[model samples]
Target: MPQKFVLRAAAIAAASALILAGAAGSASAHVTVSSPDAKPGGYAKLVFRVPTESDNASTTKLVVSLPKDHPFAHVGAQVKDGWKVVKTTEKLPQAVKVGDVTLSEAITTVTWTAAAGGVPPNDFDEFALSVGKLPEGVDSLNFPAVQTYSDGEVVKWEELAKDGADKPEHPAPTLKLVTAVTPVAASTEVDNPDTLARVLGGAGLLLGLIGLGLGLRAGRTRKATP
Candidate 1:
């Protein structure tokens, strides 16, 4: 093999490694909102995915702030083991009619403190909330969150996306409210792109090895003949 080819291959490998590392980092950088049954003027179960980026610390608590402007008629956290849920409510500035009766107050904040082993390092957990009658005429809703690590580090995922600019490093979890859409998988992990990428990468590598083996066998046979 030529020295130039070897150097080029080394450089290419380094570049590919960097690219994959960046992709993997971005995939689990911040919290995300996912829901398969989210639609306007309907009850939807929103699941917030929280991935612990820390290497040695676990996530101890999560605080999610709900929008006060367009208050949902109801908001309730689904029961999850190993977590203590706390919800706070306050009087609304102005009364709004939901169906027949007017609402006086709404849940403003929801905090979940880990009771057991919290989220382990390099792992993720999902918190589900059942909120009803999502406001219409809105494309999406933003849920700002505060993540607390066991190492006394706090990360605020609350930056809204700016137009015509690069994405924020810690973007708030945003859920799109659609009027119509096809059915999707119940589990958000099934739709994870990272898993798809890993599967494809493995398959491609296997095929490449097989092709290299066939080429070497052919070259050896040709040299052994004449």
Candidate 2:
């Protein structure tokens, strides 16, 4: 009987562990930026992966706005089928030089509209861009994006993450820029504190489950030893 009790408790612990891990993954399963480690005064490929969040409507459009203060001197987007890409450039307040070339205007916004079919439910799409000369002395860059649904609903992802505060409901996608040597440090700096807490909490829960299982086994053994 004690052995059976131990096995059942082990099964429950495994199930609980799976649930905790799934929740941790789900927390980060939103719009995200996947790119190479960018350095100051360097170029990197910026790719945004967007998942369709609405169940009733398909994703029809995506609009990404770049930061004005730290503008990229050169920005270009990759071509994707079934999507019409549009880039809008605007003159900067002051001209900036890049590799002996003076740039008065820079790409500010990139929008992608569905050419024929939209991203259906449970689907995702990636948009790529080449950006050069990331602003120096900045830890990260936030690209505020807007997702448009076929049903005319607009979802904005522009909230910034603040320390010691709850994560925003619609957090904007951010790309971390690191220097040549301190790449690991940059990653550590970007780790969300809440995420660390969640991981530790999950570990604690698993340990507690194991302890409970052991206690149950002991109790069953005591009862059987009449």
Candidate 3:
């Protein structure tokens, strides 16, 4: 191959690799809700995906906080291997009516703890739950989560997304409330674009600019020499 052609090919290859790496990193960033088929004022089964982030420890515990104002009338968790699921309930100061009944209490938090083993570094686990009568009053539900590592490190996933601002570093997992439409799959992973993706994309763009500058400089030098 010609030297110039080889150099150009190498630059293109490097850019492609950068783009893919950025994509995968963004995909595995944090805990997310997947396979959400819930509609406003309806029941749906959703899966929570948690990725182990500690390099020195395994993820041993997770606590997902439900919305207190728009609580789920019914929420059930699926059994997991080597893990215990616990629901903590709190009494409401004022009763809220639902489906011809008045209720004064609700499940505020769902916790999962590993019995023997846990999700190791670079690994992930998914927890499944069914919730009904999703609050129709809000546009979405925010489920802040607390993750505990085997080394006692606690990471809070409670940041909220601000209007017209970048996504919070540790934004809480959210489930948007939308009008009832065609039913979706049992669960789906979040495909939303994240900050890492944008940054990696910018890296790719920079590489293109560098190549353009090289080409223009080469053309000027050849003309001056002739």
lDDT of 3 by residue, 62-103 (tens): 999988877778889878999999999999778887655576
Q: Write the per-residue lDDT of candidate 1 for residues 93-190, one digit (tens) a residue.
A: 99877655578898888999999789999889999999877877889999999999999999999999999999998999999876764567735664
| Order of quality (TM-score) | 2, 3, 1
State the weakest 10-residue window (summed lDDT) of model 3: 183-192
The TM-score of candidate 1 is 0.70
Model 2: what TM-score?
0.72
lDDT of each: 0.89, 0.86, 0.85
Q: Measured by C-alpha RMSD in angstroms, how accurate is candidate 3?
A: 15.2
RMSD of each: 12.5, 14.1, 15.2
Candidate 1 wrong stretches, greater than 4 Å: 1-23, 26-28, 181-226
Screening candidate 2 with a backbone cut-off below 3 angstroms (N, C-alpha, C), the clashing residue pairs are none
Q: After superposition, how far is residue 161 of candidate 2 from its true place, in Å?
A: 1.6
The model with the greater lDDT, 1 or 3, is 1
lDDT of 2 by residue, 84-113 (tens): 999999998988776556778888899999
lDDT of 1: 0.89
Worst 10 residues of 2 by lDDT: 181-190
